[model samples]
Target: MVEGDPAAPYTDATRARLEVAFAAYELADLARAAVPIGEHELSPDGTGRSAGATLADAAHVLGAARRFFEAAAVFERMAGADWELVGDTLGVSARAARDRFAVAEVCFREGANGPRGETSWWRAHLAEQPLEAARDLDDWVLRHRDGDGDLGTTPVSGGLVRRVNTGG
Candidate 1:
């Protein structure tokens, strides 16, 4: 019996299949975005698929694609990806995630199976640090403000504000 690394339970073939599926998902996403809201011919040539496709169908397919990608990513993560790979899959910037994990690295003791104490683990895991300290709010605002001095140009939604035109 051939034993595999516990962290990487998936075979190479399985990983390849996952990669293929991820590509298909990306293509499907592109197609979904290219499709318009109203009914239109599937092909410019008359020999292809019929019209009547709705945005809902595209949305459903996109949702499925997202789920498929997530599943593949889960398998990838299980296949011994380090923290860097994990962060990439999770959509977090590599440097930020790595720097955050660096703290845990410092606290990590070799040969230890896990964190020594619950409180210590929680403290290390949940610690948050600002990427940049805003020493002067006025300076920060002026730096970010556009030439017209309108911070109101872009709208903020879902805690994601669009980047303002910092006339640099």
Candidate 2:
């Protein structure tokens, strides 16, 4: 009676559940198939809306489903997250997530640089670090404390300074 369709046997609830399964398993898989494998979770999958929902909301579908960390990690990688979806999984405010989004980018870029390239990437990722370091060094030079006070002003703060040699 719903329509002259072949799949009309399914009720609305069934269809909705199917749609959730399709989004998580089918759609997500198709979208990520071409991407190279990496350290992160590639395909986000759930067999039901409750399954498809965030870690915390997953409890509604299955009793053993609330896994906050897993949900956050998956949702975070997504380019955009719907408010309802975020709430279901994270149980956190959409506004909170939006605010943290900017901070997360900083961490993501630094992580991408890998420990081996930390020195070079650190300055680029943190805008304030380079500026502050430059200011301190400049002050040192201007006051004739960097090399030797024989050039200009004498070293007033301290005759010696401690610095780590990062092997630049």
Candidate 3:
């Protein structure tokens, strides 16, 4: 609303946020090793005032991509010490965040499956209605060791699926 400010110009805070997002995104890209960023990097770029925090944000955000698996791998490793951080770091409910974290983890696994970069966040999801389990789908399959090894496989629908432990 300033007189001299351009009409479409972004404010300092907004521009700073954009810069943060861009830097974080670039870092993720460099690390992804040829993976799609999708919309994960859009989260902490607007925030993350700290390096660890930004990296965590990047890990949580870009974790879904195969490249940033290392970044998210770090996050997954931390679960051993503080599992609660998953929710706070990823910005989701305890369960939902855990699910997203697992989503990122699997994306990396499928992308690289090891300590390498490779993933397709979009190809792993479904667009079906009436939300169903992730395992019900056949096209995508992901297993996370969050609690009791939540193993889930996606049907050909390619929507969101949840991990389940059938050994029970």
Of 1 and 3, the candidate ahead on lDDT is 1
| Candidate 2 wrong stretches, greater than 4 Å | 1-71, 74-79, 109-168
lDDT minimum window of 10 residues, candidate 2: 154-163
User: Can you write out model 1's per-residue Cα lDDT over 67-88, one digit (the tens) per residue?
Assistant: 4444344444434566677678
- lDDT (Cα, tens digit) per residue for candidate 3, span 12-109: 22222222222344454455543544455445656424437446655655544433333443334333523356566666566765554554445433
* Candidate 2 residue lDDT tens string, 1-168: 122343223322222222222223323333434344443433455233343334443333342121223234333444355644554555777665445443433443343332223332332422334223333433544643445536433222122122323446
Q: How many pairs collide in each candidate, listed in order?
A: 0, 2, 21
Superposed model 1: Cα runs more than 4 Å off: 1-53, 93-168
Alpha carbon deviation, residue 70, candidate 3 (Å): 8.5
Judged by whole-model lDDT over C-alpha atoms, candidate 1 comes out at 0.40
Which candidate comes out best when scored by lDDT? 1
* Residue 110 local lDDT, model 1: 24
What's model 2's lDDT at 147?
52
Per-model lDDT: 0.40, 0.35, 0.37
